[model samples]
Target: MPPSPAQIRSLVTAYLDRHPGEHDALAPLTSALDSAGDPTSRTTLPGHVTCSVAVIDRGARVLHVLHRGTGLLLAPGGHVEAADETLLAAALREVEEEAGIPASALVLTADFRDGPIDIDVHDIDASPARAEAAHQHDDFRFVVHLADDAPDLTLQVEEVGGAAWLPFEEVSSPTLRAKLVASGLDGAIRPVKLEQHAAEHPAPAVRTEPAAVAPAGAPSGTVPNIVGVHLYLERDGHVLLGRRHPDAAYAGGSWHTLAGHLEAEAATAGLVREAYEEAGLVIDPADLELVHTVHMVERPGDDPRIGLFFRARRWEGVPEVREPDRCVGWRWWRAEDLPEPIVPYTRVAIEGIQAGRAYSELGWAR
Candidate 1:
């Protein structure tokens, strides 16, 4: 079902939170929502809410289709329809209808979950043949990560004549282009590529630059085990986890607890810093209790690391995206029902903590 009037209002409010400067530009939309019978209805005068999808690959290329009606290269999009449940769903449906890329192959970026990356308001020419008067479209633009580097595309020849992937800089929408460049998502290497690199360079002695920097001349070929802190914030039988962005150096696009590597500070101090820095949560050291520890190695020949999980008895503020580069958003999951694609050790650590075990080991040879 199409979104209700209240839903439209909430979406506009969220979008404004991100781009406050665009409030004046969106007045028509707000006014429509205020006076409307149905702002999503095609018959609404002045303007209505429309949606577009931007398909970006791991390499940072965006998909554009030659729109048959206008003979212009554009992202897949159209007016909202009754079958759509949300603006984002409408955008995704349009992509599949016009570009033939199934929903299974696309993952919406974290930033797009709250609202569109861009909202473009523009005029549409009158169509005499269809007996439609001139109007405007408050086009909500969303971005999605394409899983495959090269996917077969079957265009709807009636609306889309051809399709091609273009570099991000060449994207037609100036707002979208600027945002994409600033986001640095184009530089993110997918997990599959990281695995391929590890396979090619075997890991006993060689480590990826991000995780392998040796301490100041300690030893010739020695890689030290890095120590990190994890926060286990539980409320009403649920624990918190954040979905790492695809661009993260480790476990990109996977679920993990709030965590960070310890610096020169004490472990508890480091946890407090990371809590505020990553999730906008303020935790007190006195309220923290040592819960569990995991000694883990990602692979057979890789250097090991120590993860110290600490449970916070109390904390201030709700979990939010303070570091977009590392995580998209934080969600609470039941102890028995966790989401998939979670970091392997993270799952183990959570289970151990629940079982009242203080320490566990993983990825070591028997």
Candidate 2:
């Protein structure tokens, strides 16, 4: 049955309540969805809604199709069609079309009959081949269990390389793994809770690199890069991330490591100031560890960014939201349990930390 506008709002609202950690991450997306003149239309610009499903077997194996175009494994789903009556209907239709599974063989839990299993909002890369500009997608994810232990399946050859059922741990791609983790299929999604300034420790050691200089060219004194520092705060079994407020100029509603721009000061000093101002944490120059540096350019016209990502092994004060204007709240997250729609560069840094890499770059011409 098609859901009425009121029902749709109720379903989405309850889904967000179950996942408070994503409240900050999905704040603006939800706001736009709720306030739209003609909500649920796929043609909406800047962002749109898509539906996908995580297909699992009785043995807890997940189904994945290797996308031929991008050569990566992804779930079965697509944009909402105008004829679609509801989000669940759209997700089920994609599964049936992409997996060639009979409707009777898919087990839709009654718990999810009214709500999605998870929600992911990610930025879309703008490419000339596809007409989409720089926009985002609020992907509603549902879970379907296979009734039959073994079922006959066919592939959408034009889009998929092959399809397989494997344990969640066996998923090889980092992006795919992160999405699976976010979907809560393996029970890794962490709940949202801000740890107030509870306890304090001595400041950590610090080291920082100098700001990048302009290249040798026609004229002088030009600042070619924006210098920023991101602190990787670690506690007993989790790391800290702040959710950018919905009213911020950029990255509003995305979870990011503690970071701020360098303002006429050394990166080390700037980081210290930002730590106190943003998270109410104090540190010494000696406890900081240089884990990685990211040289990234968001677009051709935007200034390049030289970011120093530090690992703060120890610091004084429990994580807190000292600056309400910048970020609304803070939460401790496991690497395997990070929420969706994180700042893309910050996600790269977290992955680098797990893989023991020292540095990386993004959005640069190869």
Candidate 3:
């Protein structure tokens, strides 16, 4: 005859009181209460106990198995603490800490059963070392949803040796059930081993370039005339405009096309790279048709600057100020109704884009 529900509850409560801080010892106490069939005899065992269990699922139909060095397989569960106000809190906490999954991500699939009579404690320690251990949990069990298709199991290294999903048919055996029950007490299954290999691998060396010296022929602090690509993207006859951030030194509070200075380090791909970063839009470099390259010699004693403008017929994503420090706003405006206080260089590029000219030879034309 199975132990009465009241007797089982009393046994669990007593056991919990004796093992105040022993998390692993609760397994044996549970096992002892489970095996006691006589209601009168059950009183001999500890009665006070508080523990938690998790019924985890992977949103599928397969069962997760772990090799925890115990002969029996079981679900994931552990003892509750004085700080744990309720068993549900304890159950969710244990699953996350032991399984490395967030509690919020797990969906509780079953109602928690109370009383020791509803629990099972199987003891099957094939190993002599585990058999002699006083506080070893042979296994613990949880009913988790495993799909017909297997899901990836990322095992917590400290708690489980290895984990896998086994078919229900493969697990429905008396011998396997006994082993699973033992392992479940500890919340682990056996891990698979792999082979080792040794091979020759070489480390690469790093290279460095020397600092540059000022050329005697050139003036001091002369900004180079960078040949860059400017994108004049027109949608429904309105040109896309990128508003310069107020903090910019040259063109603060001015609107300009998507453009940047060419970098020698980027080879011929600087235009493609800059267009994407400045406008938060991507376009194929090959698709950019060179609309014009303006050769502008700055006013005497002013920094010399040159600009290359390109028109792209195709691109991806809506324009936005990806770098708020460099650009604060963006909008689409018709060529006839341009925004005020536009930069002189940007104005020249816009004129060329509007005229549909292939090149604009500009030299202090203002």
Candidate 4:
């Protein structure tokens, strides 16, 4: 008999659980299956998996072009390993290992691309005979956003020849000088010109005007803005709750749902990180869903706040209070029997749950 959806989901989940690091290895095959459906239509040969970096600055301009020793310039990226199950993971690992920066410090902007060439092969002599030739490589690229305050970098001497930053105006040059221009290095060479311009021009005054208002009839007020990949973490039909530590600055001695503030550096990634930190559980990214965004103005004396909520049912570890100071304890509670002295936003979120409303937009009257 053909497998039911539940059975198929279970089988796929089980397989994924067993090979946690095989997600990237399986992506091409998954894409092929998505497009062609028939397994026989896909290429069966193994290809060398590799990654490239496109590091953009805080102003969204391309920074230094990481180059190989032979003078070929490209972003920082490389081949995947047996331990890397996904292209993103490989890209992050390569960036940190080769660039000497932490994955948390950089933001991934684009998904891995097959790039300009769909197939790249590197042939090597396997033996003295021509028939014994071997081939390696399939190139991929990912865009990365560097922190605004990133420091001057040191090249990984063995893997990289050197790096140079290029300027926007010089990028159009026809000769190799243009490569230097395009890469933004020429700007570094001529700081006096920029200084001269700065000296000649006066700085603009700061604007204190209120932001442009929305047109009449536009939907105004707070809007729900849920993010992706945080969990609801239900067990035995009861959802979990955590009590804030008495010393917590924001919501001391209050009951609240397991949640955390998303990091500015990595918004999407922060959801997964928060789940792990707050609940002491590891969840698959694919298993989480964005449930709602709750926007609200503070009551007379309370602080104004906005919140994004998410829900997930699957995880690998049991829940616990990881930060004893930030979270004193945790318990499972039914939707009907919520604890008292809850944080205001926490109460709003739980009310969203009980009302079967996915989100709420709240506003404060001045």
Candidate 5:
């Protein structure tokens, strides 16, 4: 049975207090609760949440449906509808609708009392064909299995192009990889680890000379530029910092302030979004005060970027390593005394903040 509304809220609150590490990944759901003060509204956005279920067979082969729209193999699931009474029910319903599998054929495998096995938060880009803005999806993933007496399987013609029972070791989708790890079924046939930074992160060549020519295959007057939004969440004379999962694309194995690239959103909104996504904190734009801006470039032909640093004092939830795949851990460092191996741009911004300076630059000779 689904927990009552009050009980559900209590369960969420307990989960939040106990698993501080899950705050970032669980932010969208929590934020929905905070805004609407109800769990039902979480199924849509400003923050949207969905339920996904991984169905397994007796032979240990996992069930996968080829999504006709995205062309990627994924678990059987979809958006949570109004009629759904609980997240588990929603997961079952999606399995039926997307995979043509009946609820009687499945059994829940994970602890329903412990929220979801995993929650994925990502932006869904808008298409020119669709008159919609980019939005986010917060997926609550569950694991289920075929019943002992269940018969042979079939596929949903409209939603799924194909259905297969495959070994978990063969599932190449990163989305499925994270879910398998969380469910521990990946234990029997461990999935390939894709979070190794050494293979993805590149060490750049140091240079003492500036570029003498335009980038190859570039337009005569066109050059690229980038912008970053960083949070300087401070409280009790300390600021929040996160250690990039040694496998980050750039600056892996480095301590950096909570930051993200600018999207098609305002700087403050992006910061608010990132704070919730990276630290599981709801930062009010009104409470954010600009502290510093770092204009830096890594190499010639590299796009110039402006890092806008904002100090946030008022927010909800304590710091957490929300995106564990991207950041291994989070900490509070005294602004005056920071740890080493900091991202050079971030370190420069902090130094400027401490020195009462406003603007900074790097990777350029004075």
Candidate 6:
């Protein structure tokens, strides 16, 4: 069954939360929902909702098809069908039908959850042969990651004249291109949680660049960066450090500060959780203060991240290795005489904090 009007409204509401500026532009869609006709129906005049899918490969290229009807290169999409359970299902179905790519070969990015990454409204030319008036299309654009080794394309020749993979910057939609470039996905569909990979194995330092972050004064619709929290606990002239387990995916066997990605929580709250989970230290939210922030790209061609470092003025309990697979041990090191083999960004952050600098950047092009 096609999604209900209520479901469609909910999807738009959620999308609007991420892009409040579009409320006026999307008035047609909101108005259509209140009309007597079904917005999902192609015959519904003036405008109707449609689903589109952006298929991204591991190299971060977007698969675009030469659409025959419009004589334009665009993401695979069309009218929603009764058999489609939701907009997402409709989008996946369109991709499979037009590109010959199976749904099994793709995965949705964790960032948007089940919602469309972008919603675009465009005008469609009237078709005299079909006796159809000119109308608008409310396109709900969903993004998917193609598997690294997916099969070659088999375009539905009748509709798609040809298909090609283009860099994100080359995508036709300025809004879609900006969102994709800001996301810095590099073909990786982010895992829901980093802790899931916390197992004892000699995995190479996770070949990651950095987390997501939306910088101050960023334009609306820019994808936010992956946020993380780092705990800065100090006693006397020494600071706390941990030895990540030798088998960890990231910075294995390296000394680093107690840190973690922010899960549906405030930065300070996330830091408090990491302190207790990784080191068994009890912290009061009142005792924490923002100290430093690192806007860094760990490597070239990766998404940038925003790291929040918080200083704890007072805390209870001794630090211990609570998650052995993530961190094997905890210790203190002097500011002037820190231990070797620390995570590079961790070292930069420590120096900045000591030097009383509130912000630092790494790996960004000059």
lDDT per residue (tens digit) for residues 23-74 in model 3: 4655555555465343222123233233333332332222333536542343
Candidate number achieving the greatest lDDT relative to the actual structure: 6
- lDDT-superior candidate, 2 or 3: 2
1-366 in candidate 4: lDDT tens per residue? 111123223323444464466567555544443342322211223333355444555443443444554365545666555344234455556666656655544533322111111122233234334343344343443444565344556567777776654443332112222222333321111101001010011111101111122223447652223222224656676767887766454466787777654433343456677767667788666767666667666455322345666677577787787666467888888766778887666667766766778877666674
Quote the positional error of residue 215 for candidate 1 in Å.
Answer: 25
Which scores greater on lDDT, model 3 or model 5?
A: 5
Q: Candidate 5 overall Cα lDDT vs. reference?
A: 0.65
Please list the residue runs of candidate 1 whose C-alpha ends up more than 4 Å from where it truly belongs after superposition.
Answer: 187-366
lDDT of 5 at 314: 83
TM-score of each: 0.53, 0.46, 0.38, 0.37, 0.44, 0.53
Which residues of candidate 5, in runs, are more than 4 Å off? 1-19, 37-43, 110-115, 127-130, 170-176, 182-366
Ten-residue stretch with the least lDDT total in model 1: 195-204
> Candidate 1 residues 1-366, lDDT tens each?
466676678778987997899999998888888884788887887788898888887678889999988998988999888756567768877888898876656654534532588888889999999888999988888777775432589899998999988888898878878777777676342221111111011111112122233445556565657577899988999999999876554677899999876645788988898899789999889999999999988877554678899999999999999767567889999988989999898899999999999999998878
Give the Å shift of residue 250 in candidate 4.
1.3
Per-residue C-alpha lDDT of model 2 across residues 1-366, encoded as one tens digit per residue: 223344456567888777777678777666775673444555576777787777767566778888787777777777776545567667767776777765445544323432577777788778667765777887777666665432587887888779888776775434345555565554221111111111110011000111122334525555445567889877775778988866454576888898877645666777788898777899985778889898898777455677788887678988887767557899999987888779898889888887899999999999
Query: Candidates 2 and 3: which is better by TM-score?
Result: 2
- lDDT of candidate 6 vs native? 0.78
Point out the higher-scoring one by lDDT: 4 or 6: 6
> lDDT, candidate 5, residue 112?
33
lDDT at 215, model 3: 27
Instruction: Record all residue pairs in model 1 with backbone atoms less than 3 Å apart, i.e. clashing.
Output: none
